[model samples]
Target: MTETFPASRLWRDIPDLLFPRQCEGCGVDLAGNGTLFCWDCLAALPYLKPPFCARCGDFVAGDVPGDFVCASCARRAPAFDLARSAFRFDGALAEAVRRLKYRAGVWIAPGLGAFLAETWRAVPEALRGRVDFVTPVPLAPERSRERGYNQAGLLAGALARRLRLPCRGVLRRTRGTKTQTKLSAQERRQNVRGAFAVRAPYRAGNRLWSRWFPPVEGKRILLVDDVITTGATVDECARALKAAGAEAVYALSVARGNG
Candidate 1:
């Protein structure tokens, strides 16, 4: 008699066996490559390095005295206390983000999360221990329904798992806002204002999280997102967190728009 495997098990293994593993960035079969990114393509991604702006983590082209903010950030202050980005939103990184956000490439989260964890190691140590909780900027219920899932939430969940930190849905979108695309910088900022609110005294897991985080009053939060354009969305979320007595809020993203 020949041994037989369960039908379900065989079906489950088919995709992995036949498709093999491919580099997420380049779509090349990564069999024995031992990486989700091809060497050349990985080198091409715009990985942000140090000597970046102290406030927004944007690359600073010219030397500036002291811990200075970027020209754009200095001209118009970002609402979040601090911001860090893993990659510049261009080239292969941008394409990967678009695929993940718009094309249902949800499987890309783990790779992106790993990149974020590696990038985050360069963050100032003072801020690392201060982070008490992790929250992703929420999408409006209607938009989330249309998209089937919030990309930011997926990234946040993966990041939280890697960081061994608690992740929660604390901010809720109160209104549907216009897409930021094709909007002026000022208009984009105005559009997202007052669009988000924190659920009062955030509750999760059937328990009251009254004193779970302690820095300002309740918690110091690290907000995660797939990408940040004008920092408007994150700013609004930060305002809500602060209003709810969060000590400090830091925004981190996989990519940044045009900076």
Candidate 2:
């Protein structure tokens, strides 16, 4: 005669058995815990340190006596007032983001959101108070529908909650465009160019968040995203925000991709 376990035990184990949670970095079973990377791999992630570019947030080598500008930013300035990221998009962080992006890994958003919140808190005091509202970088409607949810939107909402700021959909992607992963950096720039626009309502009083704040008109905005690659995407997003009478635009991300 076979013996059965308690109902409570069986109920708790169902989800794990049906879909085992494993480390995104090492494949070790995560046991019911909601972390993408196991302890060891998470500890080994290469977190970004200071001396990065003031404009694009790229990691810079060597010591700096004062504010330094990366060659890329010097060549062409970004549209946003400032930019920062919590971590460099490589090693464990990169893998985790890839899974979060391509593998329906919404489970990882909590941990990533913590990193993003910490990044937001660290924004310089001089830049503080200027951010009137937070907005997520908009995805093309076709891509957003395909994914069923926008990862950047998830991050922005989580971050806004942490910062006690209202998250608003101030920007919209004008149309569908090609994926940026396969394109060259220059190609990536042109692909997203003119793809974003500030919606009419957000230009004045926002219907979704009017009680929280008057509107986006002539207000500073903090643009939230999952990662910053060539800075082109956020730059374009900022361009649209500025055009919509945003006094200034600042950008932040969970990870900063290689320049």
Candidate 3:
């Protein structure tokens, strides 16, 4: 008897054998591995654990007996009902997010979106059940033209596929704003206020509207993004969504940073 391998299998394996996929974090050869991250890198991920804020997902250092909202959230509650993230914005996760956002590394979106999907499963069913659709935080027209893609949109599409939910681009940036990296939390909030608007779906004489641009009115939405720093962008987005008649909006992101 002679051993046999399928032609399709051989064809698929040849490329991997010739030039194995490399780990995105450490550049380790992944000849047969299916995932993007190696075991060590995945294990070292800075996962956000308990004792985080109830409203926003900021990591709290010390132990707390009961529910707590961060100072920023308490000062002025965000428009979104809740926000959560998969990991703290540090270590390799931070680097991955930066690469996706600034370096046009869209390849990493699916992996990061998987993290968001896993984190979403831990959300209470009461809230998760209410989510009727998923949408991304929109990028400005200028930035989208320069980047050629919206990283948040990529993440949202990946997540929606995993969760079997409809993904739509329902919001648009009203205008371009300065980068929020250097701004204080207060300034960040002010900068993005009124910066987003919901795009009204065209009802007549459009075939794509029913499939791709369904009305969000009276529907619950899940907003996906690459990271949540000050919660300003998502809050503004939520405000616009609600103003457009969305019943509820909950936010999820790959990483969260202390604001």
Candidate 4:
């Protein structure tokens, strides 16, 4: 559903205030340069540097050579081959994302997407070239109806545009699950299980699914989201994509939350 948010529309002319102009990385007044963040916030935006887990993209403290997997990943690998994010979800970053998710902070999308683009550019050549389509984690119809906009969808659109790829909604939530926010890591994993399915063609003479986007079979799909807390949601999404014949599925998020 198109979010005709009264607040968003009311302050359309005042772009700075339409969706918060303060720096999400830090509570500072924006420079009014359309960036919505101060230079300091931009510098401190916490890019997830290397020596991390090759599987789940978590930060590894010590020097762990090439393709190293953290102990957590070694125990159990996520469904997606690789998952990455631009920042660790803590302090200002967490607050920033919360604003975007709960509040109508769509303005943060471009900045977040650009970070994902940079991460993608740094991926291995072989893996990078395999990405054929970009998609977002599907929100349940009920939650989407309540929020009037999906934060992941908004992030996917911006990130795909930055990566010069088309954004496609190729997955759909099959069931409504409890919010993963307050759940423990194990609870999170269980909560999202079997919650998603690969979206099929809508066959009512509608171009909603099949006609608009190509089939998922044999394609390298990049799944986008606002955050990766437990790897439960995106893992399920990747499972669905793989079941639908996608050769590989990668997950990207704006931030990563430590459990």
* TM-score for each predicted model, relative to the true structure: 0.83, 0.82, 0.89, 0.87
Instruction: Give the worst 10-residue stretch by lDDT in candidate 1.
Output: 1-10
Could you tell which candidate, 1 or 4, scores higher by TM-score? 4
lDDT of each: 0.76, 0.78, 0.84, 0.79
- On lDDT, the stronger of 2 and 4 is 4
Backbone clash pairs for candidate 2 read: none
Query: Model 2: which ten-residue window has the lowest total lDDT?
Result: 1-10
lDDT of 4 by residue, 1-259 (tens): 2334565453673565444556676667765555646788777666678887888888867777787877877898777989888888866666667766776666776766777888877888865556787998988898787676888998899888987888888888889999787899889878988889877745566666565556788989899988898788888899888888888899998888752
Over 4 Å off in model 2, which ranges?
A: 1-23, 27-38, 202-214
Model 3 Cα lDDT, one tens digit per residue, 70-125: 88888888889889999998888888888778765666787888889999999878
lDDT of 2 at 13: 60
lDDT (C-alpha) at residue 245 in model 1? 79
Candidate 4 backbone collisions, by pair: none
Which residue pairs clash in candidate 1? Answer: 213-218, 216-247
Off by over 4 Å in 3: 1-20
The deviation in Å at residue 170 for candidate 3 is: 0.3
Top TM-score: which candidate number? 3
